[model samples]
Target: MADNAKWYVIHTYSGYENAVKAAIEKSVVNRNMSDMVLKMEIPMETVTEVTESGVMKEVERKVFPGYVLIKMILTDDTWHLIRNIRGVTGFVGEANKAIPLTEEEVAALGVEKHEIVVLYNVGDTVKITDGPLASFMGTVEEIDADKNKVRVVVSMFGRETPVELELDQVEVVQP
Candidate 1:
């Protein structure tokens, strides 16, 4: 059902991701826009930090702050409803045109789409495919199986550092 809905990014006022998502959900329900409006989400990641008491705490924080992903079939009425929602600024795909996310791009984002592979696991060795650490090899420190993300340590400036990256962005290389 979610895959049938076209994905679009909605820009919201800073610190208003949840509010805009809720407002859109409520509007969709009240106006009976179920056919066009499917699902809404605020992408978040868990982060651990030390508190004043010297205790480590894990909290959920937005991966892309002030942005919410909406899976829906865009129509004039649906667009009107979403645009009029409080805290919503605009959509990200186009200025005047509503460009739907391609299936591959949406799938790569690991939102509302199934992962294409389950090849790598924690302790598996992989080579970075892109980014600054490109071509560097590292062992997977953690695996976000659901989101298809992994934390790997690469030698940067002669120091080993861990960095989070998408699963698809790395290639598993046997040692």
Candidate 2:
């Protein structure tokens, strides 16, 4: 295993996110590939939903269905192990070739970057970069600095719904 590990996307069967993630983790541990396989993640977000009792509940939902992200040092052996994992369809690169993601690309995709930035504070206006609110301008209602997230209000379906957005997915707008 090399010191430089790159991120890559793995396509899995839909609704098998947890299964694939578990399988990858088990494989890494069982095969003693901890150094090569660093992190396995199924990016998810919490959504507030109204229950039948009219109480709002927070539910965690996958941001990208049928997809999992992994950080690993790519090698023939490492690739073989990950590719053979159950529930994984294939890597998201050229056929039979696993292209690891660059640091910049990973950061842009909302994955943790090596270099961290101070997130925008409350009351700051910012432009949404990705997601359904992309290109929409909104003021930060609150900042969860520790989590690198912010609450922004965007008009949806004629109502202002507050959405929690990752810091990297927003660019501060100066008035």
Candidate 3:
């Protein structure tokens, strides 16, 4: 609800991940608790796997086996509801307490994607604002929004050096 909801990790029995997720989703819809149980996710990744027949195939694999990520407002009712679910062993935390993930952890897990807008384009002069190369001025050479990567050519030791940086790490240098 609003900003109160936080993402929590639920541990489950191995091989029952999908079943537990489905059951919780069904319960949420039936109980009309959509407002409290905001979202559920089983983070996945696609990998190229070689089959026994020597054919390369792309397969979707769970990033975290036996674990499900849930974004919800933690309360007694919601906690009991989820804890009682068939396959859920418990929430990941200390002393049986459910600890919500921090913003950095959530971002690192790829549960949510933060949209970043870039004001500088290739050939634009910008100043690095973060990381080891902070405060260095450079010319943007390439921008990859999908990966949030930017390649900049900076003058170091009086020689041009190319460095890869995050999109948010640089700001456009004004005329």
Candidate 4:
């Protein structure tokens, strides 16, 4: 089932990352294995580079060369589908076995992002729910949803101290 899908890393030839990904994708589509093979990705990052002409340009570079990540529900048929793809060396695991990445590993790799809903906004009173400031009540000074950061002004030692915390670290103070 889709709930069983997990991310696994696969190795390919030095320059065959794209080729291997395409082959596996095409095969999945042909076999109607969309439910088995949920998603595939070649992690890439954009970097600003200075060209020979002194012009600045953004270039997309592979985060992990010769590696592709696939989110799939592991099974013999799915394993064989990827194994038979041209240019694929094997899955990154012990004795050619595929191991699904742990939840922590997946989060560290930034392969998936969980959406967060912010209930409190600027000027609202919130209570710190995490970190050293847990149980501390503060007034929201600023909220940056894009960066998942919030600036809260809390009264400490009779003085107002502004602290920055993660968006999820605070909750609206119920009336």
Best model number under lDDT: 3
lDDT of 1: 0.85
| TM-scores, each model vs. reference | 0.62, 0.62, 0.81, 0.82
87 Cα displacement, candidate 3 (Å): 0.8
Name the top TM-score candidate.
4
Candidate numbers sorted by TM-score from highest down:
4, 3, 1, 2
Better of 1 and 4 by lDDT: 4
RMSD of 4: 2.6
Better of 3 and 4 by lDDT: 3
Pairs with backbone N, CA or C atoms under 3 Å apart (clashes), candidate 4? none
- Residue pairs clashing in model 2 are none
Pick by lDDT: 1 or 2, better one: 1
TM-score of model 2 (CA atoms)? 0.62
Candidate 3 lDDT over 32-78, as tens digits, reads 88899999999999999999999999999999999999999999988
Q: What lDDT does the true structure give each of the candidates?
A: 0.85, 0.84, 0.95, 0.93
Q: Which residue pairs collide in model 3, if any?
A: none
Locate the minimum summed-lDDT window of 10 residues in model 3.
1-10
After TM-score superposition, the amount by which residue 34's alpha carbon in candidate 2 deviates from its true location, in angstroms, is 0.8
Backbone steric clashes in candidate 2, count: 0
